[model samples]
Target: MSNTQGPVLVIGATGRQGFATATSLLEKGWPVRAFVRDPAAPKARELRSAGAELAVGDLDDEDSLRPAMEGVHGIFLMLTMMEGVHITAKGIADEERRGKTVAELAAKAGVAHLVYTSLQGVHQDSGVEYYDAKEHIEDHIRALGLPATILRPVLFMDNFATYNRPTRDGDNLVLALAVLPHLPMPLIAIQDIGRFAALAFERPAEFLGRDLVIAGDLLTPPQIAEILARTAGLTPRSVQVPVEQISAFDEQVGKMFAFFNSRPTPPIDITALRTTLPDLMTLEDWLRATDWQA
Candidate 1:
């Protein structure tokens, strides 16, 4: 376990953040053991092709995770709440259970370090069910006295390409969200989360027991729209849709936005984070790197 060359197990290795982390670890020449439910799945196969050893298992089942933890030095744990994307009570409970089970199993295996990806403001009692669920797992990790690092990432920049993508409105591409036009929202590229996780594993002494809240940039909705328009060659405008409207459409997301509006801004020290990961991508940088054409 003390051996740095030993594999670092990546839970949920097929998902966005997990895939990024597993690839980062492999690129850094660290042996990676990807914990996947289906080793033959596309992303899992992709990891294997890139030199990762697959450990097939489900997070809900503790016995299934044991073999993955065996002989591993560290674990990059991220239980994405895709199951509860709509935010149901059962989804929240299932996520919390999955996360805690991983922490408990990691501790029992005597892994050297555990890096958990959580959301920002989970400690502020935001009453956001998903964030609260993550906080519960964080508490469990601490209570177990596991040597761990917690990375609290802010909003994902990738949201723009999916659910938050701009909609065409006559001559303009309209971007709408529950946040005010002037509120500075912290944003991060998912790849940077992977880079930061790799950094933590590489420098265990500096990161162990630390709770790092990370973001690449902070911009208002209007500012974000301007960047998108300028980079993607589209006429973009941002409108502040009422939180109530958002809640009417998606109750869970509405609660998150309501919490976002309640706070002046999220807690993320980009300046300090830069000292650690100087190559963190800004919105413009991210836009340039991807195929974000309208």
Candidate 2:
């Protein structure tokens, strides 16, 4: 592999963000070694078909990861809390352990660069358990003296297509979220996150030791609803769900929303980000590109 296009081992390669990163790297002519728990999985097979070499392994098993890290130019670290969305105290602990393990292994393997995808505002004490765990992992990476680029991405725009999708209410779609109507929420496409990761791996001098907060656009729920109506051809109504109601269902998600409401607005400069990543997508751009439907 060429120095600029060295092989990259992408953790969580079958997942949304990891798949994007791996695909972007391959598009840039960089070799990709996708670390996956199951090589037979559809996404993993897709990655292999798209020119990524599959490295079957689980993050929990250090031995499984060591072989994948061998001779890799860089590592893209993406860890899930509790293996999915539901975050418990034990889940938080497991997340930290997994993160620290990856960092430690990367350092041991003498990897050239490590790119970690952390949550936006995780540097601050959000009082959210999972956020705190991510911060701790960041600290561990720094403490290990790893040559790493930390990308703190805002909420994924893809969430609107799945997790926070609008439900049909007669002829109109009801977009109900715990966020306040007027509060501007920063969002980035999962694909954009991958694009940035590839850029970092290609140009380590500009990205190493840097912690970037990335966002494609900042829009309120109502504005997002409007975008959905205009871009996706849907009659959408924005409903601000009570935080308490969400808390009653999912305490972790409720705490996350409460923290979002606590902040007046997320701190992200899209214009500046555009200078770095010219193709950084806006809500409309994402909607049009994905052909998102309610």
Writing each residue's lDDT as its tens digit, candidate 1 over 38-113 gives: 9889999999999999999888777788988999999998876655346677788888998888888888899889
The predictions' CA RMSDs to the true structure, in order, are 1.8, 1.6
Models 1 onward score TM values of: 0.96, 0.96
- Give lDDT per model, in order: 0.88, 0.89
What ranges in model 1 sit over 4 Å off? 1-5
- Candidate 2 local lDDT, 1-294, one digit each (tens): 235535899998988889999999999889999999899999999999999999998888998999999889999999888635566788889989999999999999999999999988786667788899999999999999999999999988999899898887776777888998989989999999999999999888899999999999999999888888766566879999999998887787788999889965556889999999999999889988998877
Error of 1 at 252 (Å): 1.6
**Which regions in candidate 2 have their CA more than 4 angstroms from the true location?**
1-5, 83-85
Best by lDDT: 2
| Predicted structure 1: lDDT | 0.88
